[model samples]
Target: MLQSTEHCHIVRNSEILSGEPIIRGTRTPVRAIVEMWRIGVSPEEIPQRLPHLVLSQVFDALSYYLDHQVEINEYIEHNRIPDELIDPRVRKA
Candidate 1:
């Protein structure tokens, strides 16, 4: 079931990524947006990469992240692929 957050564009559903907060009506997680921005992707270009999202959704996801840093950061860390799980050839230096 979908659950609404304080933000209008953000929501969570237990069936989706175990209830990770996501942009409403899409499976794209707010973390995905944050991660992209963290890696230097500009807001204007986010939708180009995540075509499913618009500028408003991208900005809202970022706003939600700011409001719930601890929660979202936990998800980020938990979802990260550990070095041991990385394939030898695919692992980053």
Candidate 2:
């Protein structure tokens, strides 16, 4: 079953992505949407890149990010590969 916040399209369920805020009815994390936007993927392009997500869902994810920057940033950092764990040759400059 899917759950929803009264103000947004984001949802959280313990069984889904370990309870990370995700687009309702999908496992796509809100952080994922923010990261794409941060990397210059426009809202218009997000749905094209992730066809499963409608424009409203992408916008909601971004709105959620704006309202909870620290939370989502922590999630991004926590899930990122540690620099030390990367092979030196494969690490970006």
Candidate 3:
């Protein structure tokens, strides 16, 4: 699982995203992973899309989500853009 101290493999610190918890070194947030799983994406497919991540990390992140459901879910909800501002076609829009 991703310890709070362990930097995400995809999340980045951009002044724009309010420094939200992201996938690692990018603006992609951990929420994306949660959304993908919600949509039936297999754990194996994640690595193909995110070559930088190992399957273990992906699983670990999910485990982290399960263990910290309330905190992580709140983070996702807080970071979510409003429907009035986002395109519905976007993954988690």
Candidate 4:
């Protein structure tokens, strides 16, 4: 499964979640990447933040996101958190 980053097992198709991509074999939403980044988690530290994911998978997801920025951006925009609703703990205070 880790052999082909092209297989990109981290992506999945689902009826719900708007069929938005996800980490393969898990409902661990891919949107977490954007959320983490927004909250200042560096790309290099993503795997450490989510220990279940391999570093390669995290990097690949970012690559995929970059490659399909239009779609990923749309997804992120649609899922944007209202500033008022963001957890103060995560706020850039």
Q: Residues 1-93, candidate 3, lDDT per residue (tens digit)?
A: 322435345333646366555555445566677767878988899878887777776776777677667877888788667887876677462
The local lDDT score (0 to 100) that residue 54 gets in candidate 2 is 96
Ranking by TM-score: 1, 2, 4, 3
lDDT of 1 by residue, 1-93 (tens): 889989999999999999999999998999999999999999999999989899999999999999999999999999999999889999766
Flag clash pairs in model 4.
Answer: none
lDDT leaderboard ranking: 1, 2, 4, 3
Misplaced by over 4 Å in model 4 are 1-7, 86-93
Which TM-score value belongs to model 1? Answer: 0.91
Q: What is the lDDT of residue 81 in candidate 4?
A: 83
Query: What ranges in model 1 sit over 4 Å off?
Result: none
Score each candidate by Cα lDDT. 0.94, 0.89, 0.66, 0.70
lDDT of 2 at 86: 98
Flag the better candidate by TM-score, 2 or 3. Answer: 2
Q: How close is every model to the real structure, measured as TM-score?
A: 0.91, 0.85, 0.63, 0.70
lDDT per residue as tens, model 2, 1-93: 456665378998889878889998788999999999998999999999999999999988998888889999999998989999999999989
Model 1, total clashes? 0
Error of 1 at 82 (Å): 0.8
